[model samples]
Target: MGEIYVDGARCQGHARCWALAPETFEIDEEGYGKVIPGRENSGDELNVRKAIRNCPERAILERSDDEAPAKNEEVATS
Candidate 1:
């Protein structure tokens, strides 16, 4: 599974991510993009990548299995 993170402070409420993958991304009541926890890897990887790339603010980030942090504590800390 992959992980998605959104820097809410950088979000401009453009909602492009939501438009591209509503199932994976949502706008909170405050109008910022909220990457639904645990749902990031449920959708198509290409769709997720496209949505992240289309974000005007570049607030969206994705880490795939191969790119994810190692399970070791030292690796996580680093």
Candidate 2:
């Protein structure tokens, strides 16, 4: 599986990533890109990669396989 990361500080609010992969990415009201909560890699890899590549500020990141956490793992809630 693949995991995606977003650099909020570097985001330019272009909405390109969100536009390309709405299922995997979401844009805040301010227009910054976010990897949909708990869905960093739930969508197609090609689509995610496209979002990453299309990020103008290079704020998007991705890690694959062993480097990424499993999607089914339980999340600890406070």
Candidate 3:
């Protein structure tokens, strides 16, 4: 399975990630990105990667299999 992470401090609230994958990402009350739970991986690896790449601030992050967690991030959404 895969995991989603976001660097809230780096997030500019551009909403690009949310726009690309509404089912997986949303804007929190504070305007930060909030990822939907239980659907982090869900086999939508390509879409997840797209969302990550689409992040304007490059705040979106992904971890798969045995890969180490990316740097300077948190589980802001999931």
- Winning candidate number (TM-score): 2
- Our tally of clashes for model 2 stands at 0
Q: lDDT of each structure?
A: 0.78, 0.77, 0.72
Model 1 TM-score is 0.68
Residue range 1-78, candidate 2, lDDT tens digits: 456778788998998988888888888898888888878655357887787778899988766556566544535332
Expressed as tens digits, the lDDT of each residue in 1-78 for candidate 3 is 457767687898888878887778878877789677766664356676788878889897666545645443456544
Error of 3 at 60 (Å): 0.9
TM values, all candidates: 0.68, 0.70, 0.65
Ranking by lDDT: 1, 2, 3
lDDT minimum window of 10 residues, candidate 1: 64-73
Candidate 1 regions exceeding 4 Å error are: 42-44, 63-78
**Candidate 1 structure quality by residue, lDDT tens digits, 1-78:** 456777777899998988988878989887899878778565357777778879999988666667665666567788
Pairs with backbone N, CA or C atoms under 3 Å apart (clashes), candidate 3 = 35-77
Per-model tally of clashing residue pairs: 0, 0, 1
Q: After superposition, which runs of candidate 3 have C-alpha atoms over 4 Å from their true positions?
A: 42-44, 63-78
